[model samples]
Target: MVKLDNVDRGILHELQLDARNRTAQEIADKVDVSASTVRNRIAELEGDGVIEGYHPKIDYEKADLPLQIMFVCTAPPTERSEMVDQILDIRGVVDVRETLTGRRNLYVEAVGTSTTDTVRISDSMHAMGLSIESSEILRQRQVQPFNHFFFTDPYADGDDNGED
Candidate 1:
């Protein structure tokens, strides 16, 4: 595991808020370090795979992709891989996760311009011999980093609480 000093943690916290606005010099100023030090630390973090590539959070509505849906799919044991592959081929699919549920073990997140497009993608999944047990539109107002929030000291060796 990568070891993050306080400065590194501060840099990450700042970047998470506004990835595009800060430069190494600015980050150094905030963390009270040299610009080169900040740059080197960031590079080291990136090299260690602790810091992934930066990304722009695009507003889907502005991008003409407003509708969002989640699909819970179930497939025959033998056709699971094929069904997953077919679902990934759908145009609007953004994410797919293999869940642990008997009725529907696959969760798919997709975005499209309209409900019709979302339905078309669902229909295509049906045509691929995949059974969609349940589907729903996801209205996400706020998203938070639950893992980070809950597990602040991820490397702690002892039991998190005495309750366990």
Candidate 2:
């Protein structure tokens, strides 16, 4: 684990808000540091493996795969590795998470053109001998960058309606 000072955390907060658009100078402006300092810190962070990589924030609905299905399963310990690899290789599989605490050890998400494809993916997992406890998804609600809200609230530029 990294032990970051207040300034380091502040720089990270700014970067988290918008890594693509924010330049080092802009981030330095927000965090009260020189641009060179921000640049150096970021380089160090990347070297230390703290800042791994950047990714485009994708909207699944806008993409062709509007239907999302998550399968929560419990597979034998022996089969976990192979099951994960197979899941990753499967078409339409977007993400797979292994959990420490739950009736299900793995949560696998797959995007489908329709509900039938989602079921087919789950059934294939069953064929691999995984015990699927549940398969469900609703396209109604989602929150983006929700996990980092607390870390970067100081730099957020969004309008708040708390007064109203």
Predicted structure with the largest lDDT when compared to the true one: 2
User: All candidates: CA RMSD in angstroms?
Assistant: 7.1, 4.2
- What digit string (tens of lDDT, one per residue) describes model 2 on residues 1-164? 87776567767766766788989988888767899999999998888888888877677788877888888899877667667888887788878887765458899988888878887887788888888998888565453442342444544556331110
lDDT of 1 by residue, 1-164 (tens): 97777777767765665658878887777667898998898888889998888876656777888887899888776667666777888999977887656568788888998878988999988888778888888776365332242236432445432111
lDDT of 1 at 148: 48
In candidate 1, stretches whose alpha carbon ends up further than 4 angstroms from where it belongs are: 74-88, 98-104, 127-130, 145-164
**Global lDDT of each candidate:** 0.74, 0.76
Q: Pick the candidate with the highest TM-score.
A: 2
Clashes per prediction? 0, 0
**Per-residue lDDT for 14 in model 1?**
57
Off by over 4 Å in 2: 78-82, 144-164
TM-score of 1: 0.68
TM-scores for every predicted model: 0.68, 0.78
